[model samples]
Target: MSSKREEELLECPICWDSFNIVENVPYILWCGHTLCKTCILSLRWAEVKLPTLPVQLPLFVSCPWCQLLSFRLVWKGNLRFPRKNFFLLWLVESANGNRVRYCPSSSCDHNFVLPSNRSTVSRNGSSSSSEYLHETPRSSPRDRQRTNHSLLGGWRILTLLMNLTAKFPVVIIFMLIVLYVIPASAAILVLYLLITFLFALPSILVLYFSYPILDWLVREIIA
Candidate 1:
């Protein structure tokens, strides 16, 4: 894991504060973005999109940065989500040595270790020995290969469009100029429909699939 610089550690994406590792413990989303727990809690009402199992209360979290949607896991009622970035947590501890305190309410200050698995309830409503993130570095190469292929396909299509734009820049420029040359209302409507089909539709599908996509990912890791 790459060591995060101190300046990067201080900036919380949500609240924009110098978030600490203890109470404001960082939680990772399937998209691999980390946010302060407090900020995540405040997003309890975030809209959940795609749920494969159709559980009674399927949770979802939308990445504020990338706008990518992911399955928001709830071990109990909180957004347990992905494993806490333990590597990052330890880095913060090592850098802030002696100054790090796990609990804010306790008078006796000490760093806090992650909770035991027995203490946390599994999604299947049974006791589990494995913590949500315990020993999770076991992704299979085949699954990864398939995902990479899909991404590569998307990239190739995008590159083709970019090449076309570059080769026929005048044609594209003329089309844009033609659109604006039309009546204002007609131009706006044309532009809106074009953007919706070209950008919005694909983005929505990607976000919708993100939940199941990552679930398969976690299973591959666990396996």
Candidate 2:
């Protein structure tokens, strides 16, 4: 990609500002639109510490922009955007010598630089991200694949179910009217919808509405 296009990509669609990895890092929503981390964090006021997932990746934070409803993981005990655009992170870090600032007043056109962070540096001075959630470093292909699977395994089936059932309240009632109440002669239509809904609805609802509730139960049994 050209530098201009990359700069455009690094710009957050929500705030229309250049991304600062520290605050305005790009967070991809479930809908796949990337927004500034600051924007996503400001949308939710509820603060809770989620338990770490064993053999699990990040926890799901509700996508405020998705409006339709989707989840992603909460990286911090406080409000930290979990899904990161590391490529963007590298781009910003390599910005040579730029400072991060917050525009305190809405009227302020100039940025007021925030106090420099006391970034954790080892005794030997290697920067470590043990505190805040940061992107993983490069790894072997097998390790990468495993990590990828861990991240997507929980979401893939869940996403499919959500998409399938999203129009259900209208579709289900329509199906009931046609499948049972309509003329019995419409056998073909009834057979198809019946079989499809019957086999799919149970799993769909379980994944969409009830998966979180059951997650603990399954974990307990596994333990």
Error of 1 at 159 (Å): 24
| Candidate 1 residue pairs in clash (backbone atoms < 3 Å) | none
Estimate the Cα RMSD of every predicted model relative to the unseen true structure.
31.7, 27.5
lDDT of model number 1? 0.59
lDDT of each: 0.59, 0.57
How far is 14's C-alpha from truth in model 2 (Å)?
A: 1.2
The count of backbone overlaps in candidate 2 is 5
* Window of ten residues with lowest summed lDDT in model 1: 101-110
> What's model 2's lDDT at 33?
57
What is the C-alpha lDDT profile of model 2 across 71-166, one tens digit per residue?
544544544444675555655664322222221244232333333454678999898553333232333556535534543453455446545655
